[model samples]
Target: MGWIKNAKAATLGEDARKAWDAGSPVFTPILNMPSSNAGLSGRVEDWEHMMAAVLAIGWRLHTWAVCSDSRGRPQAQPLFVRP
Candidate 1:
């Protein structure tokens, strides 16, 4: 089970890197919530949701850095690694 999660995380990381290198937005499916609940929630916090999702899947936030996108907009990119 742990190995499977690790493999998934590794794949996701690779895909994210490729997208980032191509100056594309990295959309993490795990962080997405149902659109219908958007109004009810009002606002969604990123870090909180990320932490919850990663922890639930037996992973941890190894590190993060501020990276620039294609539009030169700064974004905090988190790297998740297996614990």
Candidate 2:
């Protein structure tokens, strides 16, 4: 088997982190950075990059029960993390 956990525990980009940090309206997805941020062109390609970061850090697309503030959204979720 492969180390899915280890693989997912890799580096997450900064933008995705920033977007995620902004937080959602409790149940919605949160991603905002205007149409000027490097990959904020409102295109699918940009979203792909964001998704990569979320997955790399082991967050489910729309299932992970993780919560984060906008200031530090990319910080790892506590589920797969160790104490």
Candidate 3:
């Protein structure tokens, strides 16, 4: 995501306001000099690393269902019982 911003900045060049006005422009990944991350090693690749670690240590993810009551109030109910 940061790389995309840098790419847009390089393309827009010196006019940050124009880039901001562009409003989350779509960027294609390319081997550009500005966004190039060279000589980097041992970088964490997966975004779910922490989640995986938590689950490994006996944590479980639960699913919940949210519904509206008769008075238009929100209520949540767990969909399953976790052991």
Across residues 1-83, which tens digit of lDDT does each residue of candidate 1 receive?
45544555465555555545565433343333323334354443443444454445545567666555555544456666554
Candidate 2 residues 1-83, lDDT tens each? 12432233233344334544565222223443323333333353333454565555434454334344465343223222211
Top-lDDT candidate index: 1
Local error of candidate 2 at residue 3 (angstroms): 29
Worst 10-residue stretch by lDDT in candidate 2?
Answer: 74-83
Runs in model 2 deviating more than 4 A are 1-29, 33-43, 63-83
Q: Mind sharing the TM-score for model 1?
A: 0.41
**Could you list the CA RMSD of all candidates, in the order they appear?**
10.4, 12.3, 19.8
Candidate 3 colliding pairs: none
> Which has the better lDDT: candidate 2, or candidate 3?
2
A best-first ranking of the candidates according to their lDDT comes to 1, 2, 3
TM-score of 3: 0.24
